[model samples]
Target: MKYPNGTKMIKSNYKDNFTSKQSFGNRGMTLEEDINATNNYYVETDRAIIHKKPTPVQIVNVNYPKRSAAVITEGYFKQASTTDYNGIYRNKYIDFEAKVTKNKTLFPLANIHEHQIKHMESITRHGGISFIVIRFALYNETYFLQGEKLFSYWNDKLKGGRKSIPYQAIKEEGFFIPFHYQARVNYLSIIDKLYF
Candidate 1:
């Protein structure tokens, strides 16, 4: 099976050693899957209505099969997306992009596009909540970094500063998201503390 982040989950022979309560394998679950599960939990409990935006696909051609449904012969992404998730929370608009990096020292700013940065800036300008959920897969840690803070790093790069946000800087500026069994990322709780 593949996780939402497109990582394949390998079947291990050591499954018998793990308890039912255990979550993930030695590599852990992808950030995308955890966030999706968290959003589902939020929606189920009426806490917030959030969902991962589906990527727009342009169908180029289709083939009709004799015994099965039509198959897509060619397709392409319509465009690069602005963010991963967006929704209403406590009467406020929430928008954010989720990103994961395996680097241990820094998060390369190029992972985020210029248009996405502009979109985030627009959201914050209009008084909506915007941010990025960056996961350091190597460390198995995720952090919630506000849009404004992200812009600072982005702008710095444009001004010939560092082209990445160092891990130390993120640890100091971003809030660590706690992992839970049900909520997974549990980022909304940090949002409650930070914004509400």
Candidate 2:
């Protein structure tokens, strides 16, 4: 009788002396889920705090089939107004977005929204560590491209360059985030090396 609303009260790794890393991970879990697990692990270990911003929604209609069970029938995503994940870590601010693509050769810059770019800019203005973790699913490679790097190339594209960031560029300009058991993405390691 477990209805998957994702609001389930799952225990965090910090609850007990859960020192042992869990082998559990999303079997074909979306990149978002993998990042969430990693963030959960970080939060539990008192390492760093990061969270996915809730998707904005505009609820227009609802149906109350039962007194306690009202269902939303008509609604739409209010366009995302900010970056995907961000928070404070070790008394410093950390901001980032996670994107996954099936492409092998390149990552289309078009896939990133302008608003997200602006948000990352704001975070940088405040002296925060900002980055984007891109997963090239086709090659099973994940790279953490610094916000400054992305911004530089983004401006390059605006000044009449390639419409996309080639994978070779990413590999050369970005750091590979190591994957872990409980902390699936383990991006903080990359952050530690590149930022801290």
Model 1: per-residue lDDT, tens digit, 1-196?
Answer: 1235434335432232233223363234567878988999999999999999987789999999999999988987776657879999999999999997878999999899999999999999999999999988767888999999999999999999999999998999999998888899899998999998
Off by over 4 Å in 2: 1-27, 64-66
lDDT on C-alpha atoms for all candidate structures: 0.85, 0.80
- Candidate 2: residue 97 Cα off by (Å): 0.9
Q: Which parts of model 1 are misplaced by more than 4 Å?
A: 1-27, 64-68
Please give the lDDT score at residue 186 for candidate 2. Answer: 89
- Give the per-residue lDDT digits (tens) of candidate 2, residues 1-196: 1234554424332332133223344345556778898999999998987899887889999998865888988887777888889898867799998887777799999988888888898999999988999988765677999999999888888899988999999999998887788888988888777666
Instruction: lDDT for model 2, please.
Output: 0.80
Show the lowest summed lDDT stretch of 10 residues, model 2: 12-21
Measured by TM-score, how close is model 2 to the native structure? Answer: 0.83
